[model samples]
Target: MNSTFMLDGEEVPFTPGQTVMQAAAAAGKYIPHLCWHPDFAAHGSCKLCTVKIGGRFATACTVRAAAGQEVDNHTPELTHKRRTLLQLLFVEGNHFCPSCEKSGDCALQATAYEMGMLTPHFDHFFPDRPVDASHPDVLLEFNRCIMCELCVRASREVDGKDVFALSGRGTGSHLIVNSESGRLADTDFAATDRAAAVCPVGVILKKRVGFAIPIGKRTYDIAPISAQPAGDPDTGNKLEETP
Candidate 1:
């Protein structure tokens, strides 16, 4: 018999070793997480996936759901906390959503809207970060990075290239690219690699495809990410054909 655990007060069965995010996603529950992408290694650095497990705030990416464990999937207080964290994320970096090409479809932007974030309450950092546009097909905008590490992990685990890394420390920490040379074009990174595709924010973007979809027709413009069908875009999830 599969072990059962309480998810949002209902009993659900899942394997032991799977992380809480894995278990929740399997059960069709949307757990707000940024660094726990299934295609990459879990970096648990982003506190966005924090869940009250066993009465403590624990990152879901690192926590395992044990048998018979009672886990609260959603609560008013938890939502508030996540919103506050989102606010911090907004102010910590240079997130000019209006100018970003990934604005509509970005996960961070979607999560911010879902959390009802209107304005960043915290003082903005506004650090001047260098941009890497030397790559032929990708643009690395370091200023907009929230240090989610999805790109870093995708490079290492999915694309078989350990190109990106986190440098510096504390409040000033940010992403550093490519052998301390600060150019992604100088590295072995290919345009089609998963590393170039895993960015959830506008930090790393496809060169020409950013403006391809056009305004009022992008992913989020059509529907909020919560309303987006949770399936493969190609096969399981069908794109609506325009008349």
Candidate 2:
């Protein structure tokens, strides 16, 4: 018999070794998350994908789905928690949405909209993060990084380049370049490297081109993020993320 579990009162089938978030995402179900990237080992740091399984809270990104289990997602209680988390993220970063090139296509912005976060409930931190325009072909906007570490995982796993890492803890945690100079240009990072790409925020941006795509015509503009496919249908389980 196929393994199955209940998510938000709906039966979700899962293949062995798949986490709750992976199965849910693959099955057209949405669970809020940021740190969980495909192919890389799951990082449950974000806690945005937290779900209640058997009445206990757990991060769906790291929890393996077992048969006959009930997982609570899309609940009123959970929605409020997600909203608070979103608000925290907004305040933690200098995310000037109107001015950011990633405004429309940004997963952070899109997820906020989906969660109905009308405004940031907390005061903005406006942390004094610096921008690295040292790389000839790429820009690093440190202020916008939420420390999801997608770039870190993609670099080490896919590109085989340890280009990035997170430094500090709690509020001080931030993305760092794996170079003595602590700049992206000082590293052997190229535009083609996955570490130089796959940033869900404005942290890793292509140089010389900003707002090339109109706001209304961007990736998350036409479709809600949760409704979008996490993996390519033609690639046979291949995920959209790479280094």
Candidate 3:
């Protein structure tokens, strides 16, 4: 028998070395998250997956699961916190969803909707990040970046390109290209790279193929992010085809 933990009053089974998020995902339970991807190591940057375990708060993605542990998720307090975080993310970036190509398919947008973030409660930063259209095949819009570091990790760990890195500190932090020219065209990044496909927002977009899929017919349009199966990497664009 596998070791089990209680999540929202339901028993979720887990093997040794699995985190709370991993176990809950394996049990088909949805814990709202933006920075926790099964393909990568636990980052614990986004606190949206923070759950109360044994009366202490912890990030589900990094907290290892133990037998007979009780986890409190989906409570009013946690939901409110998640909504605040979403609102902050929305305001920090110029996430004008209606004008964005990744509007419907964006994990950040979908997760915001899931958390019922109707309006950006905080003041908008409106950072003057310029759009990089230097790459012949890809577009780099830094305004929509949430500092998740998915692209940074994918480029280094998977593609071995080291094409992306986070620069600056605190609120000034932003994504930067590896090239001295500070442009995507100067780097060896291709459309087929893992970093190209790993962005959860509208930051790294392919050129000339915007709006290929109608807004209403996209991934999150058909089903909410909470309904997506855990561990699935599909980000709603459906641009990549399975071989």
Clashes of each: 0, 1, 0
Q: Model 1, range 41-132, lDDT digits (tens) per residue?
A: 56787777788877778887788879977777588888889899999888889899888777676778877887788889999998889898
lDDT per model vs. reference? 0.74, 0.82, 0.89
Between 1 and 2, whose TM-score is larger?
Answer: 2
Rank the candidate models, highest TM-score first. Answer: 3, 2, 1
**Over 4 Å off in model 1, which ranges?**
229-243
10 residues in a row with least lDDT, candidate 3: 234-243
- Residue pairs whose backbone atoms clash in candidate 1: none
Q: Write the per-residue lDDT of candidate 3 for residues 112-217, one digit (tens) a residue.
A: 8888888898999998899999999999999999998999999999999999999999889899999999999999999999888888888988887788787898
Model 3, stretches more than 4 Å misplaced?
A: 239-243
Candidate No. with top lDDT: 3
Positional deviation of residue 195's Cα in model 2 after best superposition, in angstroms: 1.7
In model 2, the runs with Cα more than 4 Å from the true position are 231-243
Per-residue lDDT over 33-114 for candidate 2, one digit per residue giving the tens place of the 0 to 100 score? 7777776788887788999999999999899999998999999899899999999999998999988877767888888988
